[model samples]
Target: MSATQMDMLWMAYGKAGAVGSIRHEDDLFHVVMSDRREIGAYPTLEIAKGALISHLKPGTDRPEFRRV
Candidate 1:
């Protein structure tokens, strides 16, 4: 797998519950949270991005998947 292929993904959260998912793509992947909740299985990372965005709030100031 190339560098673009994400081996891991996380929903980085910020103050007041802001969230956004780190994205990368490869030939195939399965996205899951730190909590181990399955984000669903997709044939491609691009296809799963919609779900990632839905679970994220891009306008926050926090580092990684933390609830500050």
Candidate 2:
């Protein structure tokens, strides 16, 4: 990840409330839940966001990602 990407933070929110976060590190994007469970690392931000959204409970709305 580049310097700018490394400093960026993305918050994930779903119908249930705060779901997790996305951060760039070691050239990959990681999705970490509020409970501290790590989903996995992805090659790009879009993929990371998709993973986070997909991790939500069934019938939940897609997560809203906000940059922080």
Candidate 3:
């Protein structure tokens, strides 16, 4: 895969909360909330994206998924 593709994948995985450290094997990423809640496992990147999208400010740099 190209560098761009790899970056996209990493972005997807990261958005899914699958890029952080965790103890669970099934976890994609460890999400630590401001409430001190650590969500270890999540479903898919799309789901995570949906959950986070609304909370993101308008001018924030969002991750764009593209075909490489």
Candidate 4:
């Protein structure tokens, strides 16, 4: 499917923790958790995505990223 500009960025909850998404809003991007908590604001979506992945474990319960 074609990616839309209005896509909602969010993360999936795993056994260890929830890997939230890098939200693009207000002309800015941020890595937010599922608990409605903002980790930090990143300049680009790549940066934010990298940050989230860094927090995830490399085991079976890996964090799932969603933008649909």
Could you say which candidate leads in lDDT?
A: 2
lDDT comparison, 1 vs 4, better candidate: 4
**Residue 68 miss distance in model 3 (angstroms):** 13
Task: Kindly report which residue pairs in candidate 4 clash with one another.
Answer: none
In order, the Cα lDDT scores of the candidates are 0.50, 0.86, 0.38, 0.65
TM per model?
Answer: 0.38, 0.85, 0.31, 0.55
Considering TM-score, which of the candidate structures 2 and 4 is the better prediction for this target? 2
- The sequence of per-residue lDDT tens digits that candidate 2 reaches over residues 8-44 is 7799887777889998878888899889999999999
lDDT, residue 44, candidate 3:
59
lDDT of 2: 0.86
lDDT of 3 by residue, 6-60 (tens): 3222232234432222221243423333334454444555555544443444764
* Candidate 4 per-residue C-alpha lDDT over 1-68 given as tens digits, one digit per residue, 9 for 90 to 100: 23454445666556666656676765557787666667787777777777766665565455656664
- Model 1 global lDDT (CA atoms, 0 to 1): 0.50
Q: Give per-residue lDDT, candidate 4, residue 49.
A: 74
Clashing pairs in 3: 17-29, 18-28, 18-29
Per-candidate RMSD, Å: 6.4, 1.5, 9.0, 4.5
Superposition error at 36 for model 2 (Å):
1.0
